[model samples]
Target: MISAALTVEQRQRLVRVARGQEDGDLLIRGASVVQPATREVFEADVVIAEGRIAAFGPGYGAARVVGARGAFLAPGFMDGHVHIESSLLTPAGFARAVLPRGTTGIVAEPHELVNVVGAAGLGWMLDAGRSSGLRVWASAPSCVPASEFEQGGAAVGAADIAEMLALPSVLGLAEMMNYPGVLNADPGVWEVLEAGRRAGGFGAARRMDGHASGVGGRDLHAYAAAGLHSDHEATTPEEARERLRAGLWLMVREGSAARNLAALLPVLREGPRRAMLVSDDVSVDELLELGHLDRLLRMCVSGGLHPADAVALVTCNPAEYWGLHDYGLLAPGYHADCVLLKDLAGFEVLETFVGGQEARAGSSTPPLPGGGVDLGAGWSAATFDVPAHWPVMEVRPDQITTGMGAPGSGDTRLVVADRYGRAGPGQTAHSTCWTSGTGLTGGTLGISVLHDAHNAAFLGGTDADIRAAGAALEQLGGGVVVVAGGEVRASLPLPYAGLMTDADPHAAAAAVGQITAAVRALGCVLPYPVTTLSFLGLTVIPALKLTPRGLLDVGAWQMIGGADHN
Candidate 1:
């Protein structure tokens, strides 16, 4: 049958090929093709022409035929949600790493970069992703500054949303982390949503992603009712089920900070058609060690999920939710993207083909892959001050929270500063708090991954250590640095927006590994020290958090006395 997807010129050629009047471009012979939609498998010869499946049968002929040797041929995988910048590699380098793992498409959110450089930063990301020869579609950043309590480099408004949503490469609005705005009927929230709708009219689906973490009851309903269609923050099965019942697609994620696959995998048993898989955030080390979406797929399948169901979550389900009709399938007229797997149990990819060309998985180098991240001048400068009388932010090896402490209490100090020049030159917002019992008796750790905000966060047992650490980080452009006894102990330079490195994934991972070890030696027991410290700046998460503006009492949804030096 001639695929309706064929163009006028391609259709004529497809007709001739089916009639045996022309030879197809390529053919994979002797493979068990898994049709994810129908959950069926059939041994067949799949033929390709003009980068589309032209014919599929045992007798099909083609100019190039590769014997599959009974491998399992499945549709190329898709990452429903991801932040490519977290990998610390440029989009092209990131593609080189993950393409071998069978990821053909990605739905990315460049909010991290947007937080650092605003919309202009997103433009560079879009161009790099497109030039990589991978399908990299982004969602308009729904919360550029995230919220009022935090200070970011840029404040993206309704105008920004409308402009970004209209881009051909943009899928829709990204996860709106401001659930309070939706429930409270905030004008700013509505303005952004309305703008998204108007601009998304050019596409088939007007999608607004959600970030309602830890919210439940009627608030969940109201938030979903506000036109949000999908969520990746459902950490528990109860939350997943509730969101699913409320008509929100649940994206079960397993990333660097949190792993929700085990908690939410049960929802899949209920035949949750709306469920998808995502890695909202992942570190360079994690990507190189495990993989992208392929890692998540292995977990699902190994945990006893039906192979077809597991595959559907990454392929058909995400494609449908994102309205990407041309991808996520191995059918007629679809792009000739396929993954030849060694087996379903491990989902080990033998080869990945995109547009009928085999993707190459090449080696990478250190310091930079493709190109080095640009670090501006005056990076080594550090200007900060802490009041003598202020509440201390106590840090346990397990958690970080605020406490009341007196001078000479041996409490460690935590400080956050705006690094993006967002608040004018030399006018960066700064906040400091004291803390005890973190066990870091004599060193400082400074990093740029002030989560959600991508600011600069410094933690130290002594004032001098912190000062030295900050200077060291600035010298490296933007990265994590550990200092003790007035000397630099270890560091990792992430020159990309002070958040990510342009180094090779493996090399970046190694650098981060060294920093992790150094921070651990400085008395941090958290499994992911860099990630845990980065989250300190994320005010949206519960319990307690610190922003460049000041300390935030998340439960109360208000700023505390980190700014008020009483």
Candidate 2:
């Protein structure tokens, strides 16, 4: 997409085209333009000149014109918040998958990559986004390690944040997962928040995002008071209402494992002024099988939301929140980023235009560098040994949050190994525990896609199977793997930062499907088993979680028991 800002020459040309003094570069005729701001739809002709909307009416001259066939021409959809890494695809690969589905812009947070490879990872993503044919704005990752309780490959301090904030593409601070630190006025957290605030000294003030899962009342107020502008972790109408009332934008998230859009629809219906739809973490399979923002629009309209209102949520609403004044509208002088939809109810995108140019899948840019995994050489089957008395983390079906299980109970064994070699000389690099509700009876599932840290994690019925899975991951560099009876069953390699791949979307989705099916064959029942397993290592979420240090009691903000290792 071309830059939103117009040059002097471009602005002059647009004015001439609007007044019919000069021919426009392109003209879209017979389109039912959907006005998101006015909540109305009307038939008109759209004139595009110098990558900006020149006018809207009939009898305009242009170099080229295409018939819309009475299709709905709406402002292209924009994702309010997303982690590009969660798609298990590089920024380039991610853009290819979503651009054809009607998402022309996104506010991406590279925390997942930062957690695994630090500031360099963020740079790599920014460079990749430049040529992805998508308008990618970044929010500097606020919590690289997510919290002090977990160990990540690298740490991003206040200085690092200040440096990132100076970049033009970086809009604000990413999700503040360390809510406890913010509430207690932790010096480090305050310093980082202050850095974001200071960036606006020379320009518009930067914004901050929140990740307060299950936080409420005075705590939520305090979080908002610290200049946090939005939250995407609300899973219920009540939660959504509280965040909205607290003066924070509500990003109603619907992703592979956590489907909260259906439950939060009431809040959006009540008042969509501060609400926008976001895909917080979509997998390749979900992106290919269902769709992107288009899928959310279909669901919202089907659930009784007015078609215009639903379109506004992904268009005008997000554009306003992000201070993108020149986007999310079809009026003259706005950037001509639009989607040609077959109908409002279905929202089937026939063509997507970014800055008046047709967008196509795949990138022309070279792939970014990979190779972030760094497990030490002493790994073996003996690394899986753990006492039966260790606490077990219980996986909640279709949710990222976990629960506590009886010690030594359940058929599945869990292990979190530090892939960055961050463990000290004497401290064990791996932690062992048990888990229930995964439904795995006879195989091992190994993943390097663990949330926040991207560590190597394994779950299995036996130590030998776990060893087999680990070996396969080590050989593939980093990715997902399934093993049983000491043989590799299935795998998918994520070569970029051990969290994403540069493969085409279809190939990546097919690989994910094979891995999901393999896990199901071994008796696992979760709809997205690989995604569910990836979250087991997240230390910020509620109830129970596992980290390389040990099993974490999230509420208590400490390890549940003494470190369990071989």
Q: TM-score each candidate.
A: 0.89, 0.96
Please tell me which predicted candidate would have the highest lDDT against the true structure: 2
C-alpha positional error of residue 446 in candidate 2 after TM-score superposition, expressed in Å: 0.7
Q: What tens digits encode model 1's per-residue C-alpha lDDT throughout 1-566?
A: 00135579997887777666788998999988978898877788888888877767767788898899899999888898898877666676687778888988888899988887778666667776766656788898988788888767677988987888877678888989888888898899889988877765554348889988778999999998889998888777888999999999988888776678887777776779898888877777777788888888888887878888888999889999888887788887777888999888888899888877786543332232211222123223434455664445544333323333454564566778766544444333567766565565557888877767777888765656666776676677788888888788788887767766556667778887887788778776656667667766777776557776676766678876655221
Model 2 worst lDDT window (10 residues):
365-374
Which residue pairs in candidate 1 have backbone atoms (N, alpha carbon, C) closer than 3 angstroms, thus clashing?
Answer: 392-434, 393-434, 412-435
User: How do the residues 1-566 of candidate 2 rate in per-residue lDDT, one tens digit apiece?
Assistant: 33947789879989999999999998999999999788899999999998889999989989999899899999999998998989998877898899889999998899988887788777777777877889888889988788887777788999999898877788888999999999999999889888888887874458788899989999999899988999999998899999999999999999987789999988877755888999989999999899999999999999888888999999989989888888899989988899999999888889999989898655654544555555555556245666676667888877788887788676678888888755455433787877899898888889999988888899875877776777788788899998988888788898777788888989999999998899899999888988888899898898888887777889888877655444
List runs of model 1 lying over 4 Å from the truth: 1-7, 18-20, 202-205, 361-413, 422-428, 434-442, 564-566
Candidate 2 local Cα displacement, residue 394, angstroms:
2.2
**Cα-based lDDT at residue 310, candidate 2:** 94
